[model samples]
Target: MNDLEELRDALHTPPGFTPRALDLDAVMTAGGRLRRRRRLATGAGAALAVAALLVGGGQMVGGGAVPDRPGDAPAAARPEVSTPGRPADMLGDPVPTGLPAGTGEYVLYGRTIDDDALPDTTFGMMLAVRGPAGDLTDRVIANEVVGPDTAPGFHAVQGANGPGEPTFGYYVGPATRITAKYSGRTVTAKQARWSADARVIFFWFAPTDGQLKMLTAYDADGKKLPAGHNVVGVG
Candidate 1:
């Protein structure tokens, strides 16, 4: 589904089993009963893992290298093979792609959100900019204040009526309603996962599509922060 749906779903689903220990007999019985499933799952997972490796190395699923799908092919969870910023000694799954490449004032990249917000909303993208464009058509996208730009609150994403432009409704301070719009095709939680770093500014949100999302964040020198101020990281 689209990012909004994914986000909504994540908001509804409650956590399942908590951390616990397994006994030998319990483990043995569970293993025996789940042997076939476990084996099939393992084999399937292995194949997918191999496929991911190949894809990461600039290879495609069927054969030759798969052309980048606007930006959605990588799953935003970091390429399985090799990539910069990916922590070394990372266990099974890769460390997820760090952000996009940019210079001048700021940089933008995609990041994965925690599972709590939205299970399917696994990723978030950010566009870092330093300055504003002369007109709305310019690179920088503007997200109006739902009420305000305050953080640390739950503000459901809404009013992303326009397809190419997505707006964010955030809880500024307390009851303030604020909306931020990014200039790009309709993006979903998965496809729109990007991040910005070092003197960069970013804004993103989801609309109605029921599918995936594809967004691009801009990097501008004017969008950069002060000499020492830290730029917030978003994906």
Candidate 2:
């Protein structure tokens, strides 16, 4: 058909079906159930775990040098396997291809709300640490969920890891920049897309000692946004 005629025909075409309104509460509940089932299958007790650990190295606690720059820590030792370890399946049913972010010592597994088939409105990310040889228990360090808000903000968690591990968390909304001060140094966190939507960003930084201070998030226009409360461990 000619371009003008095709355009006219398209405009007259009937939608194949009626659009149905989504039941947000019901959908959210279903998503929660699915998540709980997955966690049970993995034998993971809580989505978040808090403990002290060295920022770099295979061990979770004590005696590892912190990288001077964020994302520069040495790779954590991977468990030897004749084949890849079974997928944790934490992110989604068919987990995102590139996941488990971080150097080997600690990895972050996550699924953006949209990534879930049922889309858990309260789901965010899980921070995990490697365990002893052949120990498959999920060593979740933090589980931070932002709910279904579009406000540019982040939820941060801190643990008593000796020498301090990286302050980790997830940001939801339209923040393009995230930074914080820890132990008198200004640290900038590395950001990555955690969702198909541009609004969700997962971030972390080089390990720093002491309490995290003035953690801040900024939007594209350079306006500082609200920094959500720093919950002890996970929120």
Candidate 3:
């Protein structure tokens, strides 16, 4: 017999037998619910993958945790520049003549000779009398007797003022004697001593209108050495 004929024969129930109909609407509703659940699960998996990818990309690009706000970034460090007096005004006015032509006026701190005896601090202003190329001296001449309150004496020996050479001069002091020639004339003064091997001559003399009295180099027997330049400091 054919399959359909057999199923019909089997369906032919015995006496007093009955069969119930299937709920087609309920089955269709259960199938729809299963499909909706599958779609929701798939969407949730895709969302989680996308979130993981975004976090990984952020880590790769930023090297670490990302900054949450604009102000979260670290500030850049800066270098410190040391200047005397006002921080705003580091350089001073340019010296007119004595300094090298290109050099300008700036504050100079005095070096401590003996740390045990004196405080390791700036004694006074070392006026940087810079000049044109090859015209300025580099060594600093300081006075032990006078402190920074008194202006240091600066003298440039006329003929001997050369590069890498010792220029003899004097720092104004007590009981120190000075006698020399200037502008083809001899000028004598007491309380001064020879300050050899020094560029800046530290002296305790109050310059008038930024001018020091001109003098020449003298010897022990009152003999004049070479001609020299007398440069003083102002405010």
Candidate 4:
């Protein structure tokens, strides 16, 4: 009905059209060939159009056609003070996970490593929580480090313990502990120990991927605690 549509239909028509009364196979073959040719032309035209758009788009973006307003204009679209030492996040959130079979029996909280860093936290932190009576494995990721749940504290940042203060992993909401350490002579990561309310279990490893040593608390009662034994005790 529209002029543009009518023009398109007219242009597609064969110039020397005829209503033949013979040679059925010949007519069919010719018609099929014409259809194929038309289809090829259409596909080539579409490809050319897409190529043109891509080139034009690259130019528009690269040429700096977009205005640069100082107030809100973006130069380039590129896409945490927890405590003095630990991360600090005040907003409340509940972490979720699918892990060891015993998961979901207890609730989880905190951020996943793949997620954008939570407020006042590291970019690649795996924070979590386990409900009461929940097994640690199914409750937490296979290799994630976790500390015992403690009462909420000011800002959710990892605690700042130093050589002078020698802080242990306790206070909660969000905090970081020396969950891992290098034990080899080279001082590379060979062992680690996450904190709990009970005795610490240090899993010593080797250059190879195998469990070499698992040191349990030698002085649970602190009877022979080395002068500055930084035992892993939690609240």
lDDT of 3 by residue, 5-110 (tens): 8888777746474655777655444333222211211233322322332334234222323222224212311112223333221223222222221343211223
- TM-score of every candidate relative to the true structure: 0.18, 0.47, 0.21, 0.14
Please report the candidate that would top lDDT against the real structure: 2
Query: On TM-score, who's better, 3 or 4?
Result: 3
Best-to-worst order by TM-score is: 2, 3, 1, 4
Q: What's the best-to-worst order under lDDT?
A: 2, 3, 1, 4
Tens digit per residue, CA lDDT, model 4, 187-228? 211112223222222121122232212122223333322212
lDDT: the better of candidates 2 and 3: 2
Clashes of each: 43, 5, 12, 11
lDDT string, candidate 1, 1-235, tens digits: 6799899998888768664675765444333222211111123333353334323322322222222222322222321222234323221222111222222122223333222212223222322222222110111112221222223332222222223333332221222122222354434222211122221223334334432222222223323211111111111
Report the candidate with higher lDDT, 1 versus 4: 1
Total colliding residue pairs, candidate 2: 5
Candidate 4: stretches off by over 4 Å: 1-207, 218-235
Question: What's model 4's overall lDDT?
Answer: 0.25
Q: Tens digits of per-residue lDDT for model 2 on 1-235?
A: 7799898999889878787889765555444433332231122122221111111112321222222232422233222321134333345321121223233355555533223322224344544443333122333333333343334467534432333345666677677888877667777777777644466676776665565667788889999877765443511
Model 1 Cα displacement at 11 (Å)? 55
Which candidate's TM-score is highest?
2
